[model samples]
Target: MTRVRSLTAALSAALLLLSAAACGSDGDDTPKSVAPKTAALGTLTPGVIKVAVQPYSPYTSVQGDKIVGLDGDILHHVAKKLGLKVEPQVTDFAGMLAGVQSRRVDITIGGVAWSADRQKQGLFTDPPYYSPPAMAVRSGKTYKTVDDLKGLDLGTVEGYVWVKSIQAVPGAKLHAYPDANGVFDDLGAGRVDVGFLDPLIIIAAQKERPDLKISTQYLTPPTAAEVKAKPAYQYFQPYQTGFYLPKQATKLERAISTEIDAMYANGELTELVEKYGGDPEQFLRPDDAAAAARRGVDRPSDWTPPAIAK
Candidate 1:
């Protein structure tokens, strides 16, 4: 009877131990199963990503209360990849910058160019596109170079770097407008003798109105000797477009840059540009380091738009 009692006690203890082990295993898994996943970068408002945009057609614009353009499409793709929703707010160029700076918007993307001045103001992601400045004149007008517009009224978008460039020309009257359409409208109406704008904008305008003609010429960065001889032209250089984020959003910037690089590697970036009636190759940098070295700029080489993915 003593041995029987002892055996029975041992069996009970063993069963309790087994039951405790089973409960412990379940407790371990319960936390993991109910644990929340880590949030993606740039998720400012939980599931919503706010983007500020300006009226730059083919890049970003409002169409009957709907945001439609390359920038809008790109933003949507990025938001989707992060399992977030995009809320695009249409504003002017200055407002776009202010929105990002004030944290009112997570980012701004509407032909926003990456430049030294802009870098000081906010952060930028990898280059999404490239655009060289070009001059446009009324149809049947001839301008072999920007100098041809000297001493005449030159229309340019206000708040654009081109404003200073246009003002640099001797006697080139500066006519600043709120947006590209205003500049193009004045050009079409002969309110300005010539218009200084992005080559892509010039092309789009020409397509819209056959009466407007874009010069085959592009504004080139002044050579070293030229810069020394004419320091006024030092600001003139090619520009790359990117999304502007707040200065403190380093992680967000990294996230967007990674997405841009991945898009470039997968041909998604090129597809977006092509779908918007742009040349994919034109937006890519052949050799960013070499290009920046040749231009004597401190811009990022790694941020260059990569070649289309095979």
Candidate 2:
């Protein structure tokens, strides 16, 4: 009887050990359960998604603690779509890229064009929205095109692609400034013969400075390959500026891209852009899906819009 009891005890112990092992093994060690609660699909954690921005007049700006403008409006919509909440971390144009590169801000949209150099370090919006370059000069001169400034002294913003074109001219002396306002000031004071600024800012300046004149003609840089054939004038390509995730956030990247495409197809995206004072036609077509396909752009998938919490 004692021997029989010992055998039964050993069997029980073995069963316990097997049960314990089964409990501990989590199959593939993947998450067996989702978070008990989630804010929304696209919304970042509350107060997350730091945005870097500057006053790109008519598009985005900082007033008091709130960010305003077309891009701001679109971002607000993006937050709502993502089911995440965010507040703008306003900074100067010069600091925008640094903010994103350092992870201080999750994204930036201060009219930054998608250049080859930036692409080396950043991921831009799947499709560019708008790009209209302008020429700013003192009251008296006229620049029908960049070729007209062959022998002139021009002021342009440094670190901007526009400067690359302005600097390439054979006899064009370029003075680089830190900001758009500075560029205009230098040109107005005759410190530089001419300047290149964004069209919206140019319009804002005209409202404020009756003496500042801009040509109706848009001057942007041609592609590097076209430099030899095109005049050394500013010729901007369609720059689709949008939120950029860090290189590691592959999940977030795919999610945002998919949802954005959905928004575009539904016309919600274009409507929101227009509400913020942008020309939807510049970025989307009546049939957004077709438009995106034609442009070889990505579509939105899963995300939620941002909310304005009072």
Task: Score residue 268 of candidate 2 by CA lDDT.
Answer: 73
Model 1 TM: 0.71
- Candidate 1: where are CA atoms >4 Å away? 1-38, 63-66, 140-153, 178-182, 189-193, 213-217, 231-235, 286-310
Give the per-residue lDDT digits (tens) of candidate 1, residues 134-176: 6677777776554566798988776566676677778888999
Query: Would you list the clashing residue pairs of candidate 1?
Result: none
User: By lDDT, who's the top model here?
Assistant: 1
* lDDT measured at residue 52 in model 2 versus the true structure, 0 to 100: 65
lDDT of 2 by residue, 1-310 (tens): 0001243443454344334334542434323443322222222333245566666767788776456776666666665556544456554554566555544455777556554445555555543245455567666666664467788887767666667767777698888877778887776677887777665566567667766554323454345455456544324333445565544445555556566666766677666655643456544422222233223223344322221112
Instruction: Specify the poorest-scoring 10-residue window by lDDT in model 1.
Output: 29-38
Candidate 2's error at 52, in angstroms?
Answer: 3.2
Each prediction's TM-score versus the true structure: 0.71, 0.62
lDDT of 2 at 18: 37
